[model samples]
Target: MRPFLFLGVRPEDAPADDEYDAMLRCTGLDESTLRRVRLEAAPLGVVDLDAWSGIVVGGGPFCVSDPEDDKSAVQRRVEADLSRLLDAVVPADKPFFGACYGIGTLGRHQGGVVDRAHPEPVGAVTVELTAAGRADPVLGVAPPRFGAFVGHKESLSVLPAHAVLLASSPTAPVQAFRVGRHVYATQFHPELDADGLATRVEAYRFDGYFDPTEAADVVAAARTSGVRTVPPVLRAFVERHLHPRTDSGSGRGVLRDEIGAAQG
Candidate 1:
């Protein structure tokens, strides 16, 4: 069986470990089941995309909305790497899913505008699935109005031509989108639950999103905030798509440690 790849770029030692775990826990799949997650450790080289069944990207602190002058060295390098990845993935119309930071990458790759005009604070916001979204087998289990943890300083101001807006919130117009047949991008951190989002609020408090003094308040809101089901979508994606496409004979216990190791 081919393993699904998870790409992340928060510098291995970011202060938001708890938040990362919390967010991923919402994916519902056990770490063992998601056995092929990895980070772009060194160069912005072209990654081998054919080896995996799919790709999942996590959130980061870097801002895609920032101008060229303000973009960090690591951010630029990561963008270049992502560009290469997208060139390969999108052209083939491969299966892909991205959250938060991932949305900006897909939008930029597809020639959409990404900016800070619709930044949402580090709190829970309601997300309503579009008619297409409700009919989608992937999102069928999700409620019509569900809460999500949003702390993005940037979002897709306008969608690319080929993209379909799948979900939205009052604060951000493009909460989620699907490009072509297999690619998907979500503005909110679907990986995060209430507890997981609290870690991010605390870690990212002084950095922005909200007043540094109000970290306590943000934590309170995150704890009580309602959350939606994304893990089921994740499991469905892997089990429904990735599992069936594998070349390997075994499906169940493949690359368990690799999944846990790749996230760090």
Candidate 2:
């Protein structure tokens, strides 16, 4: 059972502990198996690869598109650190699942353009599988079409040359993608459901997603509409790609939380 390392940066509003608890509930990773890296408070080190089965980066309010002068010192350090990490990961084709902010990090590492061109409102969307996506070894286990929850101010304006787009929505052309073999990313929150997102809406109301006055409406809308059914995608990512790959440089980091439940 390999452990899944969860790297997070938001502390003021979205605490890593709470988010980890929710993810444990969603992904079924136990308490001891998920490690947290508070990238905001500390620098990321290459040694981090020594301890986890795979890496899972969560969403945050950090803006990768901010001007270099406007970028906080912490953000700068994290970006640099992640860049170094991806150098090891991209070549090895490690099993990594990045949501939201992960897209910008991974995209930036690969020389792709990431910005606010394809912003999507916070809510549900119908994800359509491209022909390649339909046959994608990792994503094919998911249904051809299903709704997913997404809220992003920025996206990969142009995918990296070596990247392949997996899932798309009318509003966002690259909802999901793959780099080489095992590296996967989504603009949506695969770890989030309505209940989890409600907590975020309440915490991030004034930050950006919505006006403070509209927080109630946002939560209410989430409750009423519910989350789109795309658990299979998340499950599939964990199962097919994250497990049984022993050749990766980051392989055997935890070996405790290796994903189970294979697709038929």
Candidate 3:
């Protein structure tokens, strides 16, 4: 079976590694099954969609709402790479999940209005599922309402015409949405746990998501928030796409047996 690809944009080592680990924990995938690539460190190059079971993108300090002149060379390159990847992913309806920064990337690609109008502070928020969300294959696994960790400089002010709104919060109208059938993007971090969020609070404290002095308070609040239901959405994405049985030849049965043994 092909491994799932995780595209990370955090330039810092600690937070980037932590983000990858958090994703692995949430998705129930080991290092072997979940491969990570730091886009900030290098170019995305050529990505073969068929080489992976699915793709998952993590958040970073970059903001889509930043003025074109304000974007660094790295930011510009990363955006270009993501746009190129989406060109292929959207047309084929490939299995893709993006969180935080992803909403901006996918939204922009789909003609959505992404801006700072809905900037959410670094903390937990109540995410209410839309009627469409409750029926979504991946998001339906989550409860109708749950706590989710969010901290972003921008959000989807207007959803793409072709996208279906899945979840929303009081502060951010477009908490989550789906493009085509398999592509998804969420404003909240589904791969984050309380501890993981705390780490980010410290890492991005001075990055303008919140007051630098409020970093400790943000961490404290995150620790106490009931944000456990979100990770299931990430796990569901993996389960929905990672089909070991789809592999060729004897490896198919062997891989299935390995998975069964691991589960047992």
Predicted structure with the largest TM-score when compared to the true one = 3
Q: Of models 1 and 2, which has the larger lDDT?
A: 2
Model 3: which ten-residue window has the lowest total lDDT? Answer: 247-256
Give a tens-digit lDDT track for model 3, residues 113-221.
9998988988889889898887777777666677888988899999999899999999999999999878999999988777888788888777887889888888888
Q: Report the lDDT tens digits of candidate 1 across residue range 68-93.
A: 89887778888888888889889887
Q: How many steric overlaps are in each model, in order?
A: 4, 10, 0
Q: Candidate 3 regions off by >4 Å?
A: 228-231, 244-264
TM-score of each: 0.84, 0.86, 0.90
What TM-score number comes out for model 2?
Answer: 0.86
Backbone clashes in model 3, listed as residue pairs: none
The lDDT values for all models are 0.71, 0.73, 0.85
Candidate 2 lDDT trough over 10 residues, lowest sum? 255-264
1 against 3, candidate with superior TM-score: 3
